[model samples]
Target: MKAVAIQSFGSPSGLAVIDLPVPAPADGQVLIATEAIGVGGVDVLIRSGALADYGFAEGHIPGSEVAGTVTAVGDGVDTSWIGRRVWAFTGVGGGYVEQAVAPVDEVLPLPAGLSAVDAVTLGSSGVVAHFALAHAHFAPGESVLVRGAAGSIGVTTVQLAARGGAGAVAVTTSSAERGDRLRKLGATHVLDRSGEGDADAPPGYDVIVDIVAGADLPSFFARLNPNGRMVAVGMVGGPPPADFGMTMMAAFRKSMSFATFSADTVPVSDRRAVRAGQFAAAGRGELEMVVHELLPLDQAVSAHRKMDAGEVFGRIVLTP
Candidate 1:
């Protein structure tokens, strides 16, 4: 099997494609012929050696989201899953290869109406979006803000929020062009990150999905309604502000609580449920997984380059 591995952690160029022996599934696991692998920002961070503490070491096969067909099953696993099309979160690595093995319990059947490409792109992002919306405890007619609303997770979050009955979904995009795309994804209003649109923006939103954490923290918190919740998902903007203390103090006064979605912390059963629900939503046309581009497995380096440049509007997927 051919796999993309980080030979060194520095640049996208550091990722090298090499042939490796195919891995066999262990007991309770199943081997999948990977049809699509989803690229993520965490892959970029790992490739760049920025997330070393997260245990992404050199030579690590770096991908978690995959969609494929079950080719074989290991001992103690049900044979029924063989030949079934599925999508899953690998939890660690092995997604960037022609063949990967995953615990049978972690895999979910792809909905009838979803494609492998869309399923892979929705991998973890869609699961997190679903979990985030659930955590917000939103009700019909509530308004919400989605930061980084044009990116993969942002796009899914917008769709899920709207489908869950948000009356108004305000999405923040760094560029006017991206804002237009967000609007098409169901955002009732798209706010430019340039601060020009801040004057007349709604004072308080029922929930704020903060994907771009750093600088946007202040403005995001300020826009939250009393007792509102903020789910921090990404740090695209930069590191959290040094004055996070003050920000938390403000949130404290307003009775607002901050929440974060950590895939590692989510129980396997819960994660599986969320992934299944997301796929069902996609099948029903109530949620969408935006696929910005699809590249062959050999172009994995180029895919990482595009992501690092912030040039992709949605998920970049690689087909094996």
Candidate 2:
């Protein structure tokens, strides 16, 4: 089998494809013939050695999510899963390959009407947004804001909030064209990074999904309604919000809350439910799974380059 491994740490050039023996599934695992692999920000961090605590040494394979077909099952697994189309969380890495093995527990049958590419591209983002929104406890008719709204997770969060009956959906994007696109996809308003909404509301947002945590965070946090909360899910804005303490103190009178979300904190059963629901919503045409680019597995380096340059508006998928 062929797999792309981190030839070394640092740049996209570090990624190189190499031939490796097919991995045999162990107990409670299944081998998937890879079809598509999703690229994530964490993968980029790992490649650059910025996330050392979560990374492996050179020559490591890096992929956490994949969509493909089960070719074989390991001990304690059902044979019925064989030949079944599925997408899975491949532990931490090992997905930038032709064949990847994932735990049976992490594998979900690809629901009808969702393509393998769509699932692979949107799966992780959907799951993350679902949980983040749940943690924020957003309600119908409440106003919501999503930072980096043009990104994959932001797009999903925006649509899901709309589906949940949010009265207002504000997204932050630098491009006016992208903002217009998001408006068609259910965003009630799109603002530039300077925090200008299409319209003003003094009462402010009830829930904020912030992917960009920077100096601008405090201003957004200040916009939350009384007793409302903000979830910092990504760090695209370069740094953790400066004056975070001052920001919290400013919102203290209203009892506003601030927290971060990690998919690891979500239970497997709940994750399964979110994944299934997202798949269904997408199948019904309620949620759009955006694929900004699709490249062959061997073009992994080029894909990484695009992501690093922030040129990707949605998920970038690699097909094997």
Candidate 3:
């Protein structure tokens, strides 16, 4: 089988294609012949060595999500899963390959009418967005601002918030064209990447879903309404300053709160249920899955280059 691995660190060029023996399903695992692999900000971080301390290393295959057909099942697994089209979470690696193994419990059968590309695009991202909103205690009629609203997770967050009956759904993007596109998806107001231009936005948002947490993170705290909640789910723009917490203290009188959420904290059963629901909703046309581009598995480096250069607007799927 063919797989892409990090030959080095610090640049997309570090990723290289290599041939590896096809891996087999282990106990409680299932083997999948990947049709589409989702490229995300975490892949960029992994390739750049930003997560080296977290156990990623040279020659590490870096990918977390994929959609494909089940080829085989491991011990104690049902043979009925074989030949089923499904979306799977391949943990932190092995997903950048033609054949990958995932815990049987981590795979979800795709709903009718959902394609491999759409499944990988919405599977993990939708789950994260759904739980992030819940972690922020989002409620219908509450205003929402999705920072860095161009990626899959951000796009999903916007759609979910709007469908949840948000009074206003604002977003931060790099261009007006992308903003316009997001408006059609659910965003009511669009601001520049720096989060300016609130001429028509609400005075403050009741909940903020921040995917980019950098130096500017502190600035968004001021845009929160009294008793507002802000949840950071991704650090695509890099980590915030060490003292960013001081800004939250400055807004103490507003009774505002800030939190960080990760799907890892959610139980597997809950995550699977939510992902299944999202897939069903998308299949029913109640949710939209955005795909920025489709690249061949060999072009993994090029895919990461686009992500690092901030040239991608939605999820990029790698076809094997």
Candidate 4:
């Protein structure tokens, strides 16, 4: 098996590919022949040791999303799954290789008519988007806003919100090019975060799906309607604001709720259901999980570099 491993914590340049023994499935586990591996923001964080303070160790394989075929099954696993096409959220690592071993319970069948690449593109981003929107409980005909709406998760959220019957979907993007893409993805309005404009709403929005959290959060909070919900899924813009006093006070006064979508904490069953929904939406042409680029397995470092530079507009897959 060939896998990308981070022997040291630094930049994407530190990632190296090496030959390793293919892992065998333990009891209740299944081994998958990897076809596609999804590169994610969290993987870059793990590779650079940004997550080391949280106990993520170095020298670990740096992938979590996988889509492939089942090649072998361990004791207690159903033999019927041996030849099935599936996708899984590998909790730790080892997906960026020729093969991956995961608990049978963690893998889900790929929806009919969906390719491995499409399934892999959904990955954790789609699951988190589904969870966030479903948890927010936005009513049909209500207005919603999504920060970083041109990113993978943001695009997924935009499609889901539209499918759920949102009256209007406002998305924020830094560039005019991405703003156009977001509008095509179902955003009723696109706001340029870099430009001077009234980001604050008149009455406020029904929900705010914020992937960028920083000092700008106070301004985002001002756009929330009474009882509006803000779901934080990413912090691409940087850390939370130093002075969130007004934001916190306003949220409390307006009965607003704050939530975070961490796919690691979501139940496997719920994750599978979300994937199913994403696939259905894709089939209906209502959702598009764009793949900005595809690179061979050995080019993992370059893929990470592109992600780190913020050059990828959608998910980047590693073909093994």
Clashes of each: 0, 0, 0, 0
Candidate that would win on TM-score: 3
Runs in model 3 lying further than 4 Å from the true structure = none
Lowest summed lDDT window (length 10), candidate 3: 194-203
* Residue-pair clashes, model 2: 0
Candidate 1 lDDT tens digits, 1-320: 89999999998999999999988889999999999999887778778887888777899998987889999999999999999999877766778999989988889998898999999878788877877877778778998888877778888899888888898889888787887778888887878763336555676788888887876577667777888888888876666777875876855778887787766777889888778877887788767678899999989999998887888898999999
Query: Candidate 2 on 1-320: residue-level lDDT in tens?
Result: 88899988989999999999999999999999988999887678778876666537888898899999999999999999999999999977888999999999899999888888999877889988888988999889889989888778888898889988999988888788898888888988778876675666334889999988876777877678898889999876655646676877965789999999989999899899888887887888878988998999999999889878878887899999
Listed in order, each prediction's TM-score against the native is: 0.93, 0.94, 0.99, 0.92
Per-model lDDT: 0.83, 0.86, 0.93, 0.82
Q: Cα RMSDs of all predictions? A: 1.9, 1.8, 0.8, 2.2
Candidate 4 clashing pairs? none
Query: How would you encode candidate 3's per-residue C-alpha lDDT over 1-320 as one tens digit per residue?
Result: 99999999998999999999988899999999999999988889888998899888899998999999999999999999999999999998889999999998899999899999999999889999999999999999999999999999999999999999999999999998999999999999999987787698887999999999988999999999999999999999888999998998987899999999999999999999999888889989999989999999999989999999998988999999
Return the lDDT, model 4, position 80: 98
Q: Which stretches of candidate 2 lie over 4 Å from their true place?
A: 200-203, 239-243
Cα displacement (Å) at residue 84, model 4: 1.5
Q: Which one wins by lDDT: 2 or 4? A: 2
Please give the TM-score that candidate 2 achieves against the real structure.
0.94
